[model samples]
Target: MTLDGHCAAEFAGVQAAFEAEFAAGNEVGASLCVMVGDDVVVDLWGGVADEATRRPWVRDTVATTYSVTKTMTALAILVLADRGRLDVDQPVARYWPEFGRAGKDEVTIAQVLDHTSGVSGWQQPMTVDDLYRQPDAAAALADQVPWWTPGDGSGYHALTFGTILAEVIARVTGTTLGAFLESEIAGPLGADYRVGMRGGLDRIAPMVPPPPAHVDLASLPADVEPRRTLGNPVFSAAITADPTFLAAELGAVNGQGNARSVARLQSIVTGRGRAGGRAFLSAETVDRIVETRTDGVDRVLGVPVRFGLGWALSSPAMPGVPDGDVCWWTGLGGAVVSCDLGRGITVAYVMNAMAPGLIGAPRPNRYLAAVYESL
Candidate 1:
């Protein structure tokens, strides 16, 4: 299937497999894009945007890419590092003084980026209004204590990551994450990605509901933190249409874009911080971001994860194209973005459907296998 002068062969059997999933009512609307160097060798989409309206998913449609937004936030930080404006090893309090409260003076920027800062969730129940208003949210976080000692272990930081990191960025740069991203990254590359959505809500595709629920947690092992994190009402409610939740400046999550923008931004990671004749970060800075911090069971996620600065390192738990210097992350549902440095490949998949877990669905794994095979 080819659309908009982008040629995409559905691999040996991807088209039939995609059709079968749609026929079985598994996927709603989705888009996948692959970039080798600067060329988009494959760009494909199918299925319906809305079940009731029966509107087909078109090439230009975009949706919230979930945690994949973390990659973008990470890139912004890397850009600062490249320009000698920020230091990853410096105490986060050096930029945001209020964060120094509660014995956080020693917490480095790298610790927060690696999910080891221990400020995983709000201490008290928070309303959507709390999130939309950055000052209130950031103040509350500044006042709260960590769930554990900072840099002791990893917790997913489900909703609080953006607020924490964004506050640091704002304090240091005197600009919101969204504004900086548009002026520095997206605008220069001509990528159609936005941290904060503009006034065009009608054009975006709403996320499809999860598949029919299955597998009660009581039947599983007691130590499964991933299941607990996924099932938490606080975590789910934070993401599912909260009125006060502002999209802009929320760096850890709530990124709105399609596959094209994701691949374009992440190409920096694959290309050693240079893409399309632009240098977003220095090669040394990119290497620093990818340096491994912890490779073990995460205290919050309760799974073996190898984390780099604000990105998941390629490991058995988070597989990528074979034998590549790859780092990646997925949105809440199945949306995925990975930068394969060894192969100079950037792959992105965004969809309207929200899956059940933080990891990806079987469909994405199949797609990835096909992608690797093609190479």
Candidate 2:
């Protein structure tokens, strides 16, 4: 387990915790990056990027970051709001008229951001391939009824989150979510991240799918929240390796980047919507990012979660994160990122090997715990 990159002396425990994962065989290839203010205090990568080829996980390696992509999607929308091009409080249907159909006309963009839109998953039966076709998929969602009462509570949207927000973004900006992110966010910041895979195939670290989920959708009742949200198209983590899936802009799930790139983008929130002297979000928008939208047991995830605008507020699920005004999210497998506005700390971790469950794994827990302890 030869760890690479740099870690500040004050954060040596974080480095040790990362090395211990590989030593314990809990990691394949991974990268962990920590940023304080504008400075990167810790950056590290090691292990095999591809198990089949025995390729090393280099400094520039990027992998499919699952739900971590949500943070980026959220930021893009916040940018629009910051610049007065979009309003989070306005109904999503205000931008996309068709989205108003089927009782969703009242669904606010803030509700969509907070996972309380009640359009948690597609009502129509869809194949995984349907996820790749953005326009058709977005329209399908626009025409459906909410799974639950909008804004009553949150049911993790899972995949539909991207579709819903992307449609709104497209309606407002006349650009795809990927294009808006690239031109307005990633391109300007020089962050090596994208919603879809294009170019740099050689640098990708293929993810190893985790064990199959224990939920027996077949046994569950048809209208159950988990079955409805997770079973429609069903999730297959192997999509990270599929070129066609990688090429499509599935803003909720298919974000491709390493820890460093994820931190670079998410840190804007930690900086109160400004980074590198650029104002990506206004102070008011940043406040919205941490404002508690829902704080209770999530209908789909089946756990107590505190959701803010587009990310989760601090919760016990992420034990490594310190208490304060913080917003964060995790990817399938083990990828996790947390932005602490009060402490001026942002930590991101990405990996090839996956642990069980949709969110939170032992690997990131260990590293993040070490990070705060060292601090």
Candidate 3:
């Protein structure tokens, strides 16, 4: 494999670990980027973008960033909050009046951001096709009742988090999530990332779907958390291959970008609210991102987690990571962007190759381990 891009001498270990993933058949096409303060210490990409076409993963190649899209959505809301447009502490009814229905009148935007609003997934009669229709998805979420009490605890709102937040932004600004991101975040930061595909995308990589689930959903006890969380509508990576799915605004997912774009945008958190030479958030807002909202076994992931406003706090489940104060989130298939506020470093790993589970990806962990070791 011909790895392309450069790494500062101190970050040589990071580059080697990235190449090791490809050598071990763990990564087909991937990119890793690390930025300290304003300096980009490492940027590297390699391998085949599309297995069938034998396309190389070029300098500009981007791939689906599954859940990492949530960070962008969350950042947009934070920007709005900073500009005095919306308040995270206000009830949802303050903006989108209809969202107050179905026993959710008291649910605050902060609760929703922290995954504690309890409208985890759609009500019954859901299908993959429904996910492609933004209007229908938004309406269904507005009318649905919470599976748990508002502001009580968290049940990861795997899909609904985006729709709810997007609706709030739309109700406030009359702008779609993709449009706000372009006008405010991506455009300002010179980051090439998008919440949904528009027009044709060039140099994009196709993803390798994750390995099959460990236990058949049908065979699991009906009351189990994972079964309850993932059984409805069922998620398939194959849906991502559809053009319509790519174009539609899913918000929580369907984001497309690479390691460079993610780090460029998220470096704001590490940079104390500035990236690309502009202030996108206040230092106070950046500090709020680590305020603990929930620390318990995640209903959807079935692992211990510490969720903050829009990201996860470093926890024991994700070992080898530095400091509990660091905040991060991941796309499915091992792609992750982690910002260490104390270290003044932001690291991102993006790829077409997917590891089995969403979290604790061995390859990403190894890359991060190498990064801190270099320091």
Choose the strongest candidate by lDDT.
2
Better of 2 and 3 by TM-score: 2
Better of 2 and 3 by lDDT: 2
Candidate 1 lDDT, 148-254, residue by residue in tens: 78888788876677777788789978989899888999899998888888555554677776764466655666444444433332344224333234255567677
Candidate with better TM-score, 1 vs 2: 2
- Clash number for candidate 1: 0
Any idea what lDDT model 2 has?
Answer: 0.89
TM-score of each: 0.89, 0.98, 0.97
Tens digits of per-residue lDDT for model 2, 126-159: 9888988888999999889998899999999899
Clash list (residue pairs), candidate 2 = none
Per-residue lDDT of model 3, residues 215-272, tens digit only: 6877988765566666766767666556776777778888888899999999998887
Point to the candidate with the largest TM-score: 2
lDDT of each: 0.74, 0.89, 0.85
Model 3 lowest lDDT segment of ten: 223-232
Sorted by TM-score (best first), the order is: 2, 3, 1
Local error of candidate 1 at residue 358 (angstroms)? 1.3
The TM-score between candidate 3 and the true structure equals 0.97
